[model samples]
Target: MAADMAREVKLWNDKREREMYDNFADLFAIIRTMEKLEKAYVRDVISSKDYEPECTKLIAQFKTLTTSLKDTVPSVERFMETYKMDCPAAVNRLLVSGIPATVEHRASSSDVGTAAAVAECVQHFITSMDSLKLNMLAVDQLYPALSDLLSALNRVPQLPPDFEGKVKGREWISRLRNMGASEELTEQQARQLLFDLDSSYNAFINSLPKSA
Candidate 1:
């Protein structure tokens, strides 16, 4: 009985060890993918429309995985070294930076504040619209998307304090907050929200400086 228990324990340990390595493999892949994405964006091989969402998704996944592996993967840089990974761009993007490259480029412009804010507003607007299109209509999903849009709208120095986008975004966020996190918007609600977003996006575009 003692020998059998030992064998079973060893097998269980082996299984868990394999799982950990699998997660490491996933982490490795995300990093490599991010590096390629960064290069593609720099080379203009991919449009910002195609790059931003994929970059955002990878960053989110990287964050979640790193959080889970905090105990075992104490340092991401160290992990990279162990794996012989040479993705400096991914290291900077996933580890050092918080925002996407599109936003980062705008932020480094001569008119840093306005440029960055405009980029942020555009990004959030696109994110919100894409979320709705993807049927991510649950209260939790919609609330954050709208909230981020509102926040970004507020940051644009050229936009009025009561821009239509800001007003509509706030109203939607309020409605979403009143619902349970898991609750989905009805079809009519989703339609109305999409209409409002489209209208606001057009208005936002018109509000931009002609040179921008």
Candidate 2:
């Protein structure tokens, strides 16, 4: 009976962890979507009135979800320490949560799921950069997400050759460094920044192979 109860508890804990992981994934997706919407608005693809309310709503939702995840971190950490599963999903969570896992956390062709997560994170960061204002404050806010995305990318052992070409980490790192320059940019400089970021990101996205 004690063994059975322990099994049940473990099952419940696993389920909770999976749910939280899903929540984390959803939050990234929401943030990227918000970034894209803002890009659309700035590009005049959407009206200001339409963009404002929707962006505001999404920001509120993001805050709430962020708070919930923060509250749950302790349990998640405990599970990670206890389980020590070196699988791709665990690696994904470690990356998303900014927790450093063992150096063995690498994605091979076999670890397609983790590779996809890493890819998604890279794509999301690139997308978000399009909406950045090319200002110090906006750029500062961007660094943490960029760091996280890079950390995730570093964990991939070997990406499929074609997929790798699509997510050029060096180009991204250089673009980020360019944006990080502290001097105030002129209107022309700002426009150039936007153009560069959008062009690089779009080309990366377009280069991705179609799903099987």
Candidate 3:
């Protein structure tokens, strides 16, 4: 009599299937990490300085991954339920709210003007970055995004007059103004503008009052 053999198991049968499974795994990891980050922030185990960047990155990644997985993973909540994931906090933070807890707290706080300004600044920063990523390089397109960011920055009285975001935004707006509206940013210009925007965004987030 032959000994019984154990069957080998595979989660995916083809290259496409493997890729989908990998994406699903990445999605799970992002949600789980977000849950941990949310808990740590609530407990004050991590400072806002450390928390915001990580939360922002995770939220971005989650959005990108979910968009890619839209066909296969029609619903994130369904996927979570299928996986038996118990992460209400992560669900709220990543899905329902789609913003960092610190930002939500700030928006809810009594300082409505500053809170609203900060939120506007954050939205403009994200919009500018997304536009660049999508190659929306026309001077007209880029100028408005930067202009909005600068306007939002100006609304925040807490930021100094010499803030880096303000200076870089003004410089970029000036450069764009001289160009024809239909003219597009060169690859180099786009890259530099993205870098400046990212730097300014970080500075803006860091300059936020911890209590806010």
Candidate 4:
């Protein structure tokens, strides 16, 4: 029975990873779409050299998240064969209560969940960035769902070509073949920063006190 439960847990974990595998990817897409949404925020919130540093960092960071989503998400199907929604409260509780201490600071900012929700939006953006930094932490604690997904892939006899490499050690990803094409992925390039900055602006608007 315990062995069965363990399989259940593994399946549950795999299911969530599978979900995030896509979610993380989808979030990256939203991040890209944010460019369209955050234009004004970038113009206002980030200014001069002050924003430049963050510009460089955000681009790099978003790229990392994008790559993770692209590569790790599909591994879900490659890993386990089921979605485990059997007991979701345990996982949901963690999402509600389990943001890291560092993130708690960001989430609780005098800025978040207010106004045009700029603070909240920035807070969520930052928190999502943190989640990426944390390897998108899983379960109620720090179980490496990503690593587990990798292990599970070993069982698939004919893994997809994309699934066969190690992502941890890669520092450079190039579109060498498409490099000669028209333009960049748009989502992966610097424009995405503009979107996040714009979100900040909207958040700033949303964050404004209502009594005014």
TM-score of 2: 0.34
**Residue 19 in model 2: lDDT:** 77
Clashing pairs in 1: none
- Cα displacement (angstroms), candidate 3, residue 105, comes to 1.1
Candidate 2 residue pairs in backbone clash: none
Best by TM-score: 1
TM-score against native, each model: 0.58, 0.34, 0.57, 0.24
**Total backbone clashes of model 2?**
0
Would you list the rank order by TM-score, best first?
1, 3, 2, 4
Worst 10 residues of 3 by lDDT: 1-10
Q: Candidate 3 lDDT, tens digit per residue, 1-212?
A: 13435555689899989888888898999999999999999999999878976887787667656755778999999999999999999999888887677777775657867866776678678778867875778987778778978998999998888999999999999999999999999999999999999999999989988764
The TM-score of predicted model 4 comes to 0.24
Candidate 4, position 6, lDDT: 72
- Candidate 2's C-alpha runs over 4 A off are 1-109, 117-119, 130-139, 146-185
Model 4 spans with C-alpha error above 4 angstroms? 1-26, 29-38, 41-45, 72-212
Per-residue lDDT over 1-212 for candidate 4, one digit per residue giving the tens place of the 0 to 100 score: 88877764332357767766566555444434434223423456544334322333343344335445555545422222244223232222122322212223355565332221222233334433444344443221112222332333333333333432212201112222334333333334323333433443354335335531
Cα deviation in Å at residue 76, candidate 1? 12
